[model samples]
Target: MEINRKIRSKKLSTRVDLTAMVSVSFLLIIFFMLVGELSKPKIMDLTLPNSCDISCGPIGCFKANRFYTILLDDNNKIITYFGLLELPIQSPKELQYGKNGIRKELFYINKKVREYSASIGKPNNGVIVIIKPSKKSNYANLVDILDEMKIANIDSYSIVDYYTPEETKLLAMK
Candidate 1:
């Protein structure tokens, strides 16, 4: 009496098809991947180089015999160039100094550069422009200023630390 001879398939075994589930999971992964890529914020990275180990002191105060120096200060200001304060800086949109007053600021500054070139019996065309961006200054502004400087025929350039104590003493004179 123990064994029921044949249990006529009395139970319905349910099996779930995982194909659709797998497809849905893949789609979700793709969506998140693309969204994460597109939603990323655009950021500007500025890496201040460690290559500028050379000390700029009173020696840098005077333009090198073959080098033209343009100083970039903390305020994104192009201060003191070729032994003069406020070396000509033209504005971005103006053709003449004091005209539209935008482009000429840099043009005027470059004019001073040319004058310095002539005074020193140099070509002034491929001069070296020194960048002294303050630790607190805006990097974008520095880049903009450098772009303008390049437009002004100053092709070669450098970045140096400003105000080495003795250098400050010299700058204080004017």
Candidate 2:
């Protein structure tokens, strides 16, 4: 009589349970979506001037003495002048970018304009700045100038693309 032995095989399952993983992924996506929705984009508000008759002739809408023009050129060069280039109250001067540069000039001019307006009994009227960006200028230059305007607390300013004949001559000199 010989002893007999029996062998048994263990069974294995091939299916996987992905319920927890799927739930975690969905939660992460939802969290990111909610975070994105909660954050708002920063933007600047631009106010445009109303329509005026062509007869106003460039600086006609505003008094010439209170008008301040800033010309943005390539390489961050800024040429500024008070009143018309033809008859500038404060002849065209090349200024650099930043606090000691354009910002300083702006503060000085703003104060003077305010005093002049007050002397003339037009206390409400303030300095009007005209920003003329040349074709050679970049978008960053425009934005920087706009920031300067805001920093200087300027209430009235406009971005003009066209360059006058005198302005073209002035830029050519640079």
Candidate 3:
């Protein structure tokens, strides 16, 4: 009897295949892309409060401990303040026309709105965010900010008359 030797074909070699490494790399790439997307900044949708202080008295308005005004210029800049004596808090990051054409200054406005709301203890009665747009400003800017305020859950605001509070008080007395 002759002894027979068996040789496996070199092409049939079956060591640890790299197919799993390639699949893992793909899965990792997809996971990283999804995580990066989730980390990106999102446009906040603030909910505004509905106004019930329709029949407000002058003294009642002044009785409130805090006030806030937000002004948007045509150039998409923002100016904000809490009271008559308070200096406007301008955004340190200058807001210009966003490259995308939609005014990103809206995010700044929402941040300030929350700050004012917190300062005033959430204003269960009412908190108005005055939006005074420059004559040259498009109505779109006003609508957009108002929408943002609504999303921020801040309601009870009004499109105020151009009158200064002092002027309005005098008119009320008359």
Candidate 4:
């Protein structure tokens, strides 16, 4: 006997609602942004002058009493002179590389500069450092001296290429 059979097929919808997923993603992004904003980085602020300023003129314009020159040579030998480069009045003081070495000297010199500025009724502009790296001086010594400057809180410093005869003589004096 042939029996009639009824077949029923149910259609399922493939479309999905993505509103919840989109909202969760936005929340995660905002959470990360807030966390990033809360954690701030600590850094030292160094104010470098404009390189293209023509009015800067020469280093001679800087205060002579506040000028300090550091000469680096081979064997990690550092010679520091305080005074005007134009005058050979002060002798170069030989110093080692350490806290008790150049750092102490710098502190005393800076104190003197401050006192001088106070006497002159001018602001303490700090010392102007002239770093002259000789051919015998290696890159490490130069970097060490620069680090010392930062530790000393030196505000004004410049690397000069030319070496004066007086400086050469001072270096030769052992």
**Winner by lDDT:** 2
> Residue 8 CA error for candidate 1 (Å)?
38
CA lDDT, every model vs. true structure: 0.50, 0.86, 0.52, 0.78
| Backbone atom clashes (below 3 Å) for every candidate | 17, 0, 16, 0
C-alpha positional error of residue 133 in candidate 2 after TM-score superposition, expressed in Å: 0.7
Clashing pairs in 2: none
Stretches > 4 Å off in candidate 1:
1-68, 84-125, 166-174
Candidate 3 lDDT over residue span 59-89, tens digit each: 4444232344555555555444444422334
TM-score of 3: 0.40
Instruction: Write one digit per residue (lDDT tens) for candidate 1, span 1-174.
Output: 697687587777788899999999999999999999999997644333223323358645334332334444344444444432323232112121222331345455556656767876865443445555555557775677565655554445567766455335433442
Cα-based TM-score, every candidate: 0.39, 0.74, 0.40, 0.67
By TM-score: ranked, best first: 2, 4, 3, 1
What would you estimate as the lDDT of candidate 1?
0.50
Query: Cα deviation in Å at residue 69, candidate 2?
Result: 0.6
Candidate with more favorable, higher lDDT: 1 or 3: 3
Q: What is the lDDT of residue 59 in candidate 1?
A: 43
Comparison by lDDT, 2 against 3, better one: 2
Clashes of 3: 16
| TM-score of candidate 4 relative to the true fold | 0.67
